[model samples]
Target: MANQLGIYGEQQAAQYFLSRGGIILGRNVRYNCGEIDLIVQMGGEVVFVEVKTRSSWDFGAAESVTPRKFTRMKRAAAAWLEGQPYRSVRFDVWVYVVDKGAVEHYEGIDGGAS
Candidate 1:
């Protein structure tokens, strides 16, 4: 059930991004070590986004991405970029609070500068 909710949240995030003029490059893009939840093109940058969603903030908010997860995401982003057509890239995080139906888009949350 939680997994389902998370997937639904990712879908919502993808849609929100699209509505905000983000072009969808890929979804659930996977390499050997990890998977990127969403790949989008915004402005001139290829954006790799990780989506986190939660029904409540009892434990913590959805922004809680661990170091291990970031490492995996970085590896996945590297794998993705090695075969991509873009020269510039950025990593982003989209946190969706399900109970509030709100989406917070955090650009350049990882992988250095925007």
Candidate 2:
């Protein structure tokens, strides 16, 4: 159930990005460090998305992406880049609320230098 919700959320998020003029660079890309749920290029920036989905927020879905997770995400993004050049990079959280059928985007999320 959770996996299905995640998939749906990713799809929704992808569509959301597409509608807003962002180009989809990758999806579900994985590495030894971690997985990048979505990669988008908007203007001169590459945006790395961490997707979190939940049937409800009782478990605090927005708070689930931990500092350790950010470390892994950064590593995975670097691996994915592989010398690809971008003017800048940003980390974002795309939160999907299943029961509400809503999406929340948190841009420029940080875990320090990780």
Candidate 3:
């Protein structure tokens, strides 16, 4: 059930991104130690995106990506870029909140030094 909700959230985010002129590059791309939720290109920038989905803010907001998570994301981004054909890259986070059947997006949260 949680996984399904996550997928739904990611789908919603993807749609939102596309509508905003973002181009999807990859989804659920995995490396040996980590995974990237989505890879997108917008305004000629390669964006490594991490999607966080939450039912509510009881624990915290969806943008709350821990340092460990950022580390893993960075490692995955490195692995992804090693085989990619891009010269520039950036890290972005998409926070999805599922509220009363509505999906909200908070895009481009800084992951720090990734």
Candidate 4:
């Protein structure tokens, strides 16, 4: 049930991105380092999205994105980028509170200047 909700959250996040003019390139992309929830393209830039979902906000959904997870996401994104055409890239976090079916999107979560 939890896994199903997570998948449903991912689907919601995908629609959210798409509604804002993003083109989803992949979903649940796995690499040696980790898995990326969604890979998207908006305008001319590539976006690596991380989706965090929770049944309730008792504990914030985005709060679960630890530093370790961020590092792994970066590594996975780097690995996924290898051999691909050069393009500007971004990292985004999509938080879904499933109980409310609300999505809060954080764009360019990686503050490091690209």
Instruction: Judging by TM-score against the true structure, name the best candidate.
Output: 2
- lDDT (10s digit) by residue, model 2, range 1-114: 778988988998898889999999999999988889999998889999988888876656668788988889999999998879776999999888888887778899998322
TM-scores vs. true structure, each candidate: 0.87, 0.92, 0.82, 0.91
Arranged by TM-score, best first: 2, 4, 1, 3
Q: What's each prediction's clash count?
A: 0, 0, 0, 0
RMSD of each: 2.7, 2.3, 2.9, 2.9
Please identify which of the two predictions, 1 or 2, would achieve the higher lDDT against the true structure. 2
Off by over 4 Å in 1: 61-63, 111-114
- Show where candidate 4 strays beyond 4 Å: 111-114
Cα lDDT for residue 61, model 1? Answer: 42
State the weakest 10-residue window (summed lDDT) of model 2: 105-114
Q: How large an RMSD does model 2 have?
A: 2.3
How would you encode candidate 1's per-residue C-alpha lDDT over 6-50 as one tens digit per residue? 899889988988998999989998888888999999889998888
Clashing pairs in 1: none
- Kindly give the stretch of ten consecutive residues in candidate 1 with the minimal lDDT sum: 56-65
lDDT of 3 by residue, 22-109 (tens): 9998999998879989888887788887777778656344436767787888898888888677877777776666775445454454
Error of 3 at 79 (Å): 1.0
User: How high is the lDDT of residue 82 in model 1?
Assistant: 87
